[model samples]
Target: MTHDEIWRALDALAAENGLSASGLARKAGLDATAFNPSKRIGADGRARWPSTESLAKVLTATSTGMADFAALVTGMAAALPRGSRGPAARRIPLIGLAQAGGEGYFDDGGYPVGGSWDEISVPEVGDPNAYALEISGESMEPVFRDGDIVIVSPGAPIRRGDRVVVRTEKGEVMAKELKRQSARRIDLRSLNPAHPDYAFDLTEITWMHRIVWGSQ
Candidate 1:
């Protein structure tokens, strides 16, 4: 698996358990900073990977089987348990990132609205307002490729370090990791190092939705 995929899976696992990366490491009996973003890259600018022992500890602490963890890493829905599937495949709205910034695709709250969107069928999410966005640029590369589809949940609670799709009042739509959110400003970290990070005042943001899943 790719380095990005592995880290993303770990992040997903932690989020699934309602914990942060550091919290997951703590639960696994590892150093609290073991899974922090800063730890993912070495001081020399090389990628750092988690040890097998650490992975073992995390799986044991969370009671997660390798198969389930594999599902998260590969973004393969079939690898997950059949019983965990939604009642049926549901068609959700799908639109490209470029089109997303256009006028009619989303409402003020970031919910998919209008007839301009295409649709795709996937396992249902709890949010009826959930929709999918197709990646189109290199700004979020490696973690998300040009054609990758990310499921966005407007109703989900966003936390620090979560991947999110944000729309600006000026009609700019971009995806980045949430670094911090204050009453006045929101900070975002770019997934691609080639891109610049963002810090915008709360008023500059129209809506921000948490990225719940990725079709890697």
Candidate 2:
């Protein structure tokens, strides 16, 4: 990919992930400005090449494999058809609690039996890895209310302060902001004061992922 293309992609990714290039670099354990736009342009005004080490650090920071990184660099960032941009227009089949008992988590056939689904519209997020979920309760309000549609990007990494959807081994699904994570437990801050803040044992978690964009 050209330097401009890489710079643009990195800029978009940084914005979507709520991070600056320097912040992303820090997260990736690299020197600040490793992926800065300024650094992408040489002193002679030519395109500067990205170092392999810098790319490796970024991949690790984003928890993305080389192949996935390659796909983004190739301008095939998992996007859907143009007309399917709205949340109400693109929905994935999600089996609810009533149907979840015998269903597997996701790949094991435990979630839902079919692809029947609804549609939601979320703006500015073009990744096809993004999908929508309807808020079922008022646990997260002001920011997210009951019936609000949330677009989730399973490809996004969990980060401090990011709103997330968490599934417990007991078959409970909840939404909250991530405060911290460790090998043993996760701390969650409730968006609604009426609901108690969550401190879940990590071992009991079935899955935890971020909400990329949401529309009320």
Top candidate on TM-score is 1
Error of 2 at 200 (Å): 1.7
In model 2, where is the ten-residue run with the lowest total lDDT? 76-85
Clashing pairs in 1: none
Off by over 4 Å in 2: 1-91, 94-105, 108-113, 119-129
What lDDT tens digits, residue by residue, belong to model 1 across residues 1-216?
777778988998898889999999999999999998999998999998989999999999999888778867755422234225555468889999988999988877788999989998887555788898999978898899999998887876676777899999999999999999999999999999999999999999999988878877
Please state every model's RMSD to the true fold in angstroms. 5.6, 11.2
The number of the candidate with the highest lDDT is 1
Q: Which lDDT values do the candidates have, in the order given? A: 0.85, 0.63
